[model samples]
Target: MERIAIIGCGGSGKSTIAKQLGLTLDLPVTHLDAVYYDENWKPLPQEEFAAQQEKLVAGERWLIEGNYASTLPIRLAAADTVIFLDLPAATCLWGILQRRWRYRGGQHHKDGVFDRITWNFVRYIIGYRKQMRPKVTALTAQHAPHARLLTFTSRRQANAFLSEVTTSA
Candidate 1:
């Protein structure tokens, strides 16, 4: 996998998997959150964000992680592989809580600011499968038909795939 795009809900471990894949495959990893959000958690202008993504994807190899579905087509067009973390809402909620605890009072490497587990964020995670999954599914099918698509319904499967890739590599 020279070029990979990892997409999922807010707490779905996209960044974690991307980092692991980057290390295993010796590919550069790009966290779209870092690209899109300023140090203060302010978002870049839409045009600027798109421009940045355009430049990143122009590179020969990269593992870009984010769920910016609107801009997914850009990365999808460039990637040779796509991974979708289709974990349950409970798992994702647990992940967010765990992350908040782990990174409390400090900024996460992939996040723009210190972790904050708000009710709105929780609600978004809870509703993601019903609301966003279909959209992502259609977009991937439409934009990256030739790309290798791998969907993991649980963290165990994701980790197994990572282990398999690492061993094979």
Candidate 2:
């Protein structure tokens, strides 16, 4: 599929799946974390973030992974497919924990990108659920009906979906 949008809760492996799909399809993958998080985990301005989203989705073929609710209409309008990683809350929590360990365990991301906050896990997992998941689910359902929406309930389902789907761009 061209112009795929992988939207999901934090630590749902949206970036990971998008990157893998991009590699397999020889397409470009854009991680929202890389785009939004600047040095020291500071957030970019709303205007800048919106601009970035616009420029990214302008591509004819690209895979973007994020749960930016404000950019949903823009992103989904241009996307031919939307892969929703509807992982269990437990799965996401576990993923976040594992990631924290990796980030705090001495793995540095691209220059000043991944700060690896040792304590934000609770917020991203528990707090973001009430704050973000509702918005994401609503937006996906709204813009993804015409678009191919692959909602994976678990990691196994995700892998299975990828196994059968040809990622040729």
Residues 88-138 of candidate 2 have per-residue lDDT tens digits of: 678887876676665663324342124354566556666666777688778
Instruction: List, residue by residue over 27-102, the lDDT tens digit for candidate 1.
Output: 9998988887766778899889989999999999999999888899999989899999999999998888787777
| TM-score for each model | 0.95, 0.83
Enumerate residue pairs that collide in model 2.
none
In model 1, the clashing pairs are none
Q: How close is candidate 2 to the true structure, as a TM-score?
A: 0.83
Clashes of each: 0, 0
Model 2 lDDT, full chain set: 0.74
Best by TM-score: 1
Judged by lDDT against the true structure, how good is candidate 1?
0.88
Using alpha carbons, what is the TM-score of model 1? 0.95
Candidate with top lDDT is: 1
Model 2 regions more than 4 Å off: 105-121, 127-131, 166-169
Model 1, C-alpha of 86: deviation from truth (Å): 0.5
